[model samples]
Target: MATIYESKTTEIKPFTYRTLLITPDENSEFSIKHSRQQPKHTKKVVLLNLVGRTSTDDIDSYESLEQANLFPLAHHIDNDKQEYEQYSKGLVQHFLFLIELQRLWKSEYDELIDLPRSSRGKFSFRKSDKDTHQYREAQIKALLEPIDPSQAIARTTATEYIGVVVKFYSFQIRNGYKFNKTPFEYEVVSIQYQGDSTSIGAYLGKDVHIKDLRLNLGKSRGNEGGALSSSHKNLNPITNREWQAVRNIPTNTSQVIKNVAG
Candidate 1:
């Protein structure tokens, strides 16, 4: 349990890991109220560096960590083969997903009951199949729930992209949903949408998995995936989910501080 200190005039709240990911129920769903994934009076998320897994275990509490903004990311992909297999095979895209991370304000943690997990940027709750009803309904709601920039309680020291590669080589969007009105079979890479938002050494790390989609390790969609570590293959014994990336691999330390400046 976190210790709460009550003062006279103002509530002097002691900070904890739990404080960052908490959000309300109304803001949980994909609503038209917010244009971007800004903290709209509900969610307050801080990009974490998993102490045992990715980040260095030096500070014990969140307060100590706030004092020392620097956190360590593990360099699991040291070998050229590992890097080639991961990057060339498109496993790099898996590690680095879309920008919109889920705020646990309106949800529960699946694995870590206490700690919250961040959602990938691309996956959306607003799944549409050319339905007119959905579009009409969204427009009606938009009037009442315009994406109010004022409502977006952007934390002064907050981050946008949670699925950041410990160290990234490319920031430019290599792929897109449609190129000259033609759609590609593979996923188009969506890098930092807002210019100069996410930096290299800014975020903390977390374990993530593709919930619905199972993409090939290779970039182009051929047989690009390679052998998993002896321990990580067939993690569940029922399905062929390669749990090695999150389970075994270590995130590399990123020396980069500046992101794509617009």
Candidate 2:
């Protein structure tokens, strides 16, 4: 019999991993509302950069201070605790996904290109580097078209993540965070509606022109559940027979009810 050889593969982990850390914010109004005498404690989500040297302490240091502002923006979006946490989680996931993509792109570029390790620092390309640019574009396209369907993130989830990131950037811009070049592009799209349409846009003479921000990632696939989709299952009133059946069900206090009635 021929000898069989088994090869072992080593997993490559990134040097720096960005993660979300939920901490208590004493400045939050909700915390103050709950406690009159003691200091208030509210949920404050921070994005921490692991395995990296920075001027500030790990607790205060983040991948981006603007990204850390997501917690306050999330509260403004919704005051509810659960909603705030969900929004924070989505935003964190978006940032982490981008970081992973950057790491992978750089790794691939380094392997293909004949350059000094020091020169291949960033995962960006100049206009003259046509081949490098094409490679990056191809990588982005591949991300949209998943090779393994089962491993891919759900369309709805991807949409939520992108939306959260967009909202965070918008918030930063509104607060006077100037970017040398805007991260995304925008185009004015005119939407036409019928005169008899129930939409609010119908009142604006059927032609509604709005500036739609075009994100780097392509449009999300699949339908996001709407009010109508949620309400598809119509509920009907229970009959008297069904109500009596529910009342007749045995309980620990059945004898107590009978004695009280008697």
Best by TM-score: 2
The number of clashing residue pairs in each candidate reads 12, 0
What C-alpha RMSD separates each model from the true structure?
26.7, 16.5
lDDT (tens digit, per residue) of candidate 2 on 1-262: 2121111112222212223344457665332223233332344433323233334423332233334454454453234332244555665454445544445555567555645422211222333232223333433443566676444545455555555655665555555665544444423345554655565555443333222332256554322332122222335575676455445655433431211111
lDDT of 1 by residue, 1-262 (tens): 2222111111112211211333356657543233333322212112222121213423333222221111111122121111122222122222222111122233444555654332322222333411122222333333235476333322210111111221121121232222221111223333433334565555444433222111112222222123332332232452344443334444553332222111
* Clashing pairs in model 2, backbone N/Cα/C closer than 3 A: none
Which candidate achieves the best lDDT against the true structure?
2
Q: Poorest 10 consecutive residues of model 1 by lDDT?
A: 4-13
lDDT of each: 0.25, 0.41
User: Candidate 1: lDDT of 238?
Assistant: 28
